[model samples]
Target chain A: MVKKYTKFIFFLFLIILISSVSYAKPHKQLSDYNFFKDIKNQIPRDETVPYKIANPLFSDYSYKFRFVHMPLNTAAEYSYNNVFNFPIGTTIIKTFAYPIDERDLDKGFQLLETRLLIKNKNGWEPLSYIWNNEQTNAFLKYTGHTFNVSWISNNGQEKYVRYRAPNVNQCKTCHEINNKIQPIGPKGRNMNINFVYPSGEANQIDFWHDRKLLNNIPTPLKRNPAIWDDAKYGINERARSYLDANCAHCHQKGASASNSGFYLNIDENNSSILGIYKTPVAAGRGSGGLKYIIDPGNPADSILLYRMLSTDPGVMMPELSRNLQHEEAIPLIREWISQLK
Target chain B: MKINKKIIYFMVIIFISNFSYGKIIIEPGPNAYDRIQEALILAEPYENIHLSSGYYEIEDGLSLDIDNVTLSGDGLDKTILSFKNQKSGAEGLLVTSNGVTLSDFAVEDTIGDAIVVKKANGIRFLRVRVEWTDGPKSSNGAYGLYPVESKDVLIDSCIAIGASDAGIYVGQSERIKVINSEAKFNVAGIEIENSYFAEVTNNIAHHNTGGILIFDLPNLPQQGGHDILVKNNKVLNNDTPNFAPEGNIVGKTPNGTGIMVMANEKVILEENYISGNATAGILVVSYLDEYEDDNYNPLPNKIFIRNNQLNNNGFEVDKVRAEPIALLTKNKAPEIIWDGVTSFPEWIGLSKQQRLILGPNKTKDRKTDMINLNLMTYALLPWFHKTKEDYDDYIGEGISLTEVNFKTKW
Candidate 1:
């Protein structure tokens, strides 16, 4: 019996080691899959499953479910419900799946995809899904909060409403505020609380696993890898990259407001040290009328937001190379502003 | 024969008396270059080339060589001098020859220097705005209102913003005055380099990387600048970050000073309210590399540093290697007494530190009045005494410690 137990334990240990090594490996090109051609051929022919919804007998409770067939070889469905009793707005339920082969359940190419069941007044609803061969741009645009789509019920009733992505901008902007731009997505905005997806699990992989969505999870990538990996960059790498591309290119000493002693160097520790966001009550021509310009949490009241939103060539941000409006980034910024606490 | 000749001369004189005076008005349409050029050459002096306040693309530089000629515009904001297609080797406006005034107009998006005036006297730039369309980091264009080697220039009430170099530069020229004008959002605002007899006053110098630098660099033959006074100006908050990669000399020194006096003589920095800078409030230094011999000389000689209130500020006056040593040494010693004489405790000799601690000794005498004196007998007391006894014994009696009774000739 002892020998048998030792062999069993050793076998389990070996399996765990092999699985960890495979998970550690970066994602490979999709062409490596022998099933790629079949999936590509099948994607165009698969009919777009119309969106569906179900309303139970609960009073004043409504739920929405949606599915989109994309040009790329991918499919997604999301569901959400308005719960009047809960003050936190809608509860979102989202799930994603891709075709796997049918064999021994553990060994099969077919896998039970990660599913997100966000609690609502009536029941659970899915919000978002991921597929194996998705077009990155189309996925970002369609899943973006700016789009309005139609959802049909099983009884043939259609409802149109706007759908939004999770507030990723809020997570990206603050970590990008200083020189080090670490997007603390899983970590809360305050860098204190870990973001556990509705499930009580603290670890992102564990949380996804508990939801019965993902069997193998990929490691998360940092928001800005190129600049953060460079050895010469110091301190707030992400914030520095954003500022250098945005504000500092025009707002530095000698370049523009040289007389005001307002050096916006990202490496500098104190924001007020260089008079960047300090109130310029009588700063002559360089002063932009608003008082206490960088008021931390208030982007609308802050002069920095006012300048970013301006279209005038003299007052607009970057002062060059921007041809299109960044409509999606606005809400993310608003969310970032709300999360300053 | 005489009558026939007279009749022919009378007919010839009568036919020669017919003429007409006409005026030509040239209006340049949008994107008109060839028509504007032809009109400029053909139109006589005092004739107007009325532009309709649209973007005018020109290749060659605009030169106003005629005297009393006016290049009027609809307004400064409406009319634009855009050089999008022009090559990089051209200036926006080249004004030479006297009596040229450009007013109420803007010259922007130029590839080269914005405005260059060479050897032009009596040049007036009133309410003239000059800028380039390149983002603030671009260095393709330099100088907003540039007057190089020109004399009797006046740049009044004009705004020069976002230039690669100084906003209003008066280089190698004399008798220039910049008043009631603003040059912010540029490399340097109103740089008076290698120029004499200029006044920079009552202007707000803020939000720049460097605040109000009067630099005298090495290797320029035109080195001497004197009689320049920087007074009554609010020079603050010049600690902004630098965007461009182009090297700046002022960055080598402290971040911002109200006035930086370097290698120039007879500069008066008085009564200016300067504060809130990352570095010193005022920096005065001589060029160390350029004039090696003069490095040891006392600068700001005949300078009056009196009655100026400096609050929350750092002040640095850099005297070269040789001059400030004696002044620094004399400041260390507290008290000096010559010709030792002692008798009383009140008349006791005191060391410099003792005198500093207790302050000056005093006494009172009663005779229906008060008389104060330090007698030689008081020297015996240890509390009030600071002098060595050997020096006291050497001098012996009847000599007052308070009085210097002898002198030494060196």
Candidate 2:
């Protein structure tokens, strides 16, 4: 009896040791997760769905390829107003790439980095992987990386950007809310649009619900945020959508920059909280000698427009993941601010 | 010992803790940015990360989010972290976790704030130096040693300089202690804004716009800052031009002012060497802005000023916010000036304990006086304004605020 009890204890200890070792080490290579059917071509594997968001956050104008992979037996809980809460073992992947030449469609692009947010028992854990020079595989990177790339713009202009991949803690700058790291994209309104999937064209939330990857989504989900460049939507809606994607992640209530008292979320309705004639509290040099955050009819005097056009470290909005100003979006924002009453 | 569930749990905790806690030493090199950040991300509770003495050229902002971590360096002058080419992130170094001790290092010339610790508890910054290297420019980052929305903050023996905003700024925090520090060439040196229960003593603030200011602003999560003690500090020669960028609240601070308290309550200012400030030695005023928050009170109430050596102040009145008061006082602004702005109709029902009190102020045998520029009357009816220079009306005992102590937990 004593020998049997000792054997059982030894076996338990061995199992515990193995589990601890496995928990300490996560997947080191991007390919280890195997969510791609064709890694180079960016094809999704089983239960891995490609998705798109309206008014996507800008990263020096890098084109983002996004996908979500869920565990076999689980699904994400639907949220009406906020981001969809995913289950444990869900992995949201995003690959940032810069085209060799934006004027030429057939030309190839350079994949810079792949960021992953994996939800486990503890909470959402963010990881970043940097692609190699050969563009074959990506390895895990904890600290950030910066590299220079030049690409011809769609309008036949030469553009150069020093791209930045956020470090682990920098990821929390936007993703962490109320002391918990969570997904920032895939809000209900942002994902309520139609997508051209491999199977067919359908609304993204409906597609997820049909595939059994989303649970308890209410019927007649009819909210749609604007695709910032789409001219069919009103300019105010488009500009608010853009600000919601780029700046609201940190500027909203209970987020990272709540101390500033400037809330730019889509739901924020108060004009003062939206930074109209709002005085800066701690914006030292970022103020740019401007008076109000949004000086109506004067984009040049608006601090919001000034920060959007600025590429300086402290003066820029969104504050991370981009070093260059988004020229395509700045004019739209400037136009919107000029029209503000 | 018999095998029990408690024993098993204890053994498991010990094993897991043994695998995580330790010391990590990193030397500066081309890869120090990544390696240092990686160590900060992976550090466990109670871990000590020692950065060896060398100059590190960091390209991006570094952050640490783990609790109970100690990030130390060789010395403030030895281990230098320079962010001259920082292309991304808001601040140079951001600390978001609780119980973090950052000591013995120097951070220089980032595009934004040098060091910002936010939403933390029990944070300590010791023997650290943050400088812009370019003296007092409008383009320099805001706060040097900035701690906001924190609790039990202790900043000791630090040196901050050349920031466009305040050098040592503690905002929206509680139970604070800022001791033995030196701040120079910043807009507002050593500021405590919208915070509570702070003891600021034994510091030297010089060559800045306003030395040692206590302010409370509206539209913030924390409001009604009160119960602060500013004692035993040297505030002198803060005649640097106000180099803060426009639209910042601190940009309104007049050059050459010493120890201004605005829109706060239950403040005690005592036992400080204040001199050589061209503006007033101490300015107590109300919040002068349009605010929409209904829960906000924008008045300085229950202030006690006593036992301070004041000299050579109010000689050259600043052209900014202090000009109107200087014009009213005929260019000889008193050592202490109070914008006597009070709530209407409510002031008629207040006791002596609820009013501004003035004890005996020890001066340098100079003609040091106190003035109340009836600003409330001026705002209501400018034609009927009266400036009163009397210390007898405010002579009374004020409430005894508890001193801020952090010896028990921090």
Candidate 3:
């Protein structure tokens, strides 16, 4: 009886070892974290771990679901106002999807494609994995593909947009800084907000700390970075934060639009660089008859507002991934500018 | 052993023609996009990337960062590269390499610029047609056939249209020639800004906000534009409404203006047909009239205009479009208006012969502000077109500048 029990335990151990080895690299088509299935487990397999953010860059009303998987025993360095220094081999995944009815949050969504930013030896490499129509699996999309996505808005209106999945080079358009590829979000301030993680609701920083995935972060953190849409923050703070995340990626110093002499970052103390009574450099019809980028105390005459409200391909701000204007944010920005005095 | 010297020489010629210089033809299909990108990437120096006649819809910007590579299509109209659905990046095709020639193709409807050649030298655009499919709209891309911050460039036999900014623009570069091109229906039809030693000749600029603009703008990485030649070009009827984005410099250009020069040294305009514009045929202004640009020269020095036919100007000036311009000037503006603004403290230091040189031109019956500085309200506003009290004071012809020889520079 003793020999029989020992033999049975040895066989089970052998089976577990073999399965774990196979799970390391499932296939080239599928991600290492499996499909969007299991996410919160100690060794998440088949199940997906769900995550959310306080604010996200608008993408034509398309909702996003993000997940992260870290190799065990690895930790990310702590940085302020910048992305967490993640270890090599960490994979950050975001799936672009849309709800059946945008007015109803409870409505189920149709998954489109998943973008992965895998941290490699050089840096994070961005790739797109398109989900099949049947919602079973996703395959690596080397070349970009486009498809029609239809949805219902809160007003009970039918809407549709031709969604374009960005190709690999397009991914580098925003991710690149000073010729180096980096992540746009996941900054310390963006992640400091409370999140409904698997172990109930808590600050994401604490959650990451408890999971031993982050370096030494002080208790209560260094600074509270305001999420742009939160009403608790001041309007100036919120508006500047929104512009920093969306526009500064290309408009700041040493960026693609550096020649334009515009800076929308949080650290830019100069009000003029934030587009106060500033003349445009090469904005042809994008000006919309507005004399300055911002006419202090007059939001109606500001070129900033003109570009925000416009949908014309050349006249729009934050050039891509959004066809519709962020109507809700525009008013808040207008109010912020009106009170600039 | 002097056996068959003629046969050996013929074999040598065949070998040289076959392998050392060869062409690779790429076909169109499902795999063509990736195949072409790979060919562009894997192409070696002195290699030719030839594409068969077909229409291609590319989603991402195509970039070439290698040297001595030539990309050619079957013909300009036969091969079309469209970037209407670009996901990211700015241009349809971006180049950061030297010794690259893009020829015999049409790039249309890009999200941003059609082709942007930057920070490289010895680039040439031959028999290329860059256009926006939609007619002149404010939402069109900024530039077509753009080359910035490169040297020894040639843009020959090209057609550009429907750009929000300049149809054909060369900026912050040196030793360039833009000849035998047609630019129309854009903001500034053909603009050479902040560059030195450029010859723009034998081009047609029509129906734009301002045809043929040479400006030295402030707050850019490059400044102090000088030594440009504008000759043998038809700058006609550029009365299109300004559709440029509000912040760009050209966006402020009034409709129906032709051949604008601002803050440059040593420019010669000669032998060109300048007609049918409403505002003015030749407009020279100081940079101080526009923005608060510090440490930059704002004077127009050693300019020579000769042997040009100017007619029918100020006929259909769009006064309501740019009301500030109309508020300062009359309905019949002028054939040549020089905003006589000079901040030189030593007023008596320079002779009259050292100023702008204008000669050998004729215009219709008109009494206008040739040196109009009536709008110079210093310390009042940052008006781009400043007013000068002595706007029509100076009359003596200055010394003619030496003609820039392109054959020697190139």
Candidate 4:
């Protein structure tokens, strides 16, 4: 009997050892902030819901993958600003990476970092997690990082950049509306496009409504701003929408560019304010020697087009975020301006 | 417990010794921004915050609330703080402390003003370079070295380029000096607006829409700026198209303008080389000509133009000039122009000394100083300048006014 008891105790000890190893949290956790274990390995299999964007923002030519999660019965309120007011317990995840090759997805990609914006009891909190080089678990970091990323461009040229990882407060730069941290994209207009769900490819708005992830669901959104790169939309609409998404955030009232008299928001209807024969206020060399902001029917003479085509730090529009000209969109803008008699 | 106390005491002593032995040095890496921010927070009076030479890609702009601190970098060419991908922070660096000095660094590609020193005292920007890098984009930062609503400010030996607004702008600041600087590819190269007791000297302002603007705007916290001296500056070319957004005061400035003074008093312009501007050189106008300001003084008073080599201006004149200004100066656009509208309806007994006094000084090798002096009954209407009058009657003799200088330490 004593020998039998000894064997049972040994079995119990073995179970304890296995349990401790499985639940081991090697990296430290921040107070009241939830972080994923790893970008590739430890994303919750069934708990977290993964989503994708249509017409993603160019991050110096980097690929992005997104995911979302919320507590049971929680939903988001849709607003016209294109930002949804997410309920407490909602979590949004965005991962920036580069696919090793543009042609293949199965070979896997290099995952750099993942950012989590969580809505707790107080307000939305932004956090950053940097992945380890060995593909291990990521750790929460207050300081941002930079890594050299190489990618094969559409023209088959090898491109490289030192990709920057944003710090916690940096997220608020784009996320702010009225000195408050808020989401920029993922609004009804931006998300009206199709997404591949568990069932099949369907409109993201319909999918969200069906899943009860959104609140105050309109049968159809009042207005849907089209994706700037989509050919389905008219050229004028596309250009207007593109300027709205990229420039209007800061160019609007009370934002940084408010001091400037020009407004580039999509909703702006004034033709002169829309830069038709409207002389530049302070273009400097941004004019590229052009006389006006936009010379109707003359795309080459338009300062807007000149600034868009330039990569000079002293003379480019939308002053930041791009070193290379959008090779495809330039022609569309040129055509739009050329046809505008 | 006694042993633990002794150990803690030793560590504290070492930590204190570390701070005294060496100043806070910040290098570009993960959390480098945070470390710099924390160092600013923890720094004592008269401490140095030195950033090493490298490219620092920060996500947000930085701010300092510390007093009496010196913030320096390895060098302007070597240390580049880029906010090219910044998401938030209105400016690259915002300082609201008293007696802050920044030097030998380049702030590149910010979304807003590159460096804004607001409501501070004795602020200095020495040997700093502020640039957009991509050049001349309307969406570039507004001001490069902006010191607004501050007192006793000095911006010396700085290089500013690629701003949508003024490159080296000092607004609403008292007792300020901007000297030995280079400003190019901006709207207004160096603008001193609504500030009292200011001096701008030995600076190069070129390739901008308007080189060197001294303005007194309305509806600002500070107004009625007087006693300004602009001397020994090279104001050249500046024929770039006006890229400022509509509705801004600078937006109305014609391309290729040199030394424009609007709605101020006791301004002395002397010993400056003003040339190659497409518009008239040394344009002095009243605020009453532009936007309406009830509380602000619309008339420019005690403006003394002395010893300036004004030539080659009005080569490519702006047709959009207010009808009065355009009609008054039609042929070859005079070397100097003065809009004769004061605040009052009538200038019944105003002499050349009471109004604008031109040239007790030199105009290069030219004998006659061409002047377009107007005596408009009403300042608001553009047609008043078009009215048939003998503007040449007021131009026979050019007088002089009292010269002002920086009496206070600035």
TM-score of each: 0.37, 0.94, 0.76, 0.63
Global lDDT scores for all candidate models: 0.41, 0.88, 0.75, 0.72
**Residues B154-250 of candidate 2: C-alpha lDDT, one tens digit per residue:** 9999999999999999999999999999999999999999999999999999999999999999888798999999999999999999999998999
Native contact share for candidate 1: 0.00
Across B1-410, the per-residue lDDT of candidate 3 in tens digits comes to 23254544454455455448457788766655566765765577788999888988776567776588899998889888877776544678877678899999999998888898876678889999999988898778899988987787799999999999999998887888899999998998999988888899999999999999989876566778888889899999997888886557787687888898888888888888999988778887766434544657877776777778888876665676545446666656667766665554433346443346666676556432354543344333456555542423443464443443433221
Best by TM-score: 2
Off by over 4 Å in 2: A1-19, A22-24, B1-21, B346-353, B407-410
> Could you give the interface RMSD of candidate 1 in angstroms?
35.2
Tens-digit lDDT track of model 1 for A1-341: 44434544455545655765654221232222221223322221222221221111110011222222222332121111111121121222212211121222232121112122223333322222223334221121111122233434334455443322222211111222222222111111111112333224264333323444223333341222113223454434433434433454334432322222344444445555333335431121111334434546666655555545654323334333222233433444344444443
What is candidate 4's local distance difference test score? 0.72
- By lDDT rank, best first, the candidates go 2, 3, 4, 1
Candidate with the greatest DockQ versus the true structure: 2
**Residue-level lDDT tens digits of model 2 in A1-341:** 44436546556666777876777466889999998998766788877899998778888889889999999978888886688888888999999988888989569788889999998889999999999998988899988788788888898888888888888899898998888888988878778888998777999999999888888887888668778999999999999989988999999888999888899999899888898878888988888999888888899999998888888888988688767778789989899989999
lDDT at residue B265 of model 3 (Cα atoms): 84
How is the predicted docking of candidate 1 categorized under the CAPRI scheme?
incorrect
> lDDT per residue, candidate 4, A184-265, as tens digits?
6676667776766656898777777778887887776665767788889998888877777766765654444443335677
Give the per-residue lDDT of model 4 (tens digit) for B263-355. Answer: 888888889999988886788888753332356787788787777888788766677854455555666676777766654435554543455
CAPRI band for model 4: incorrect
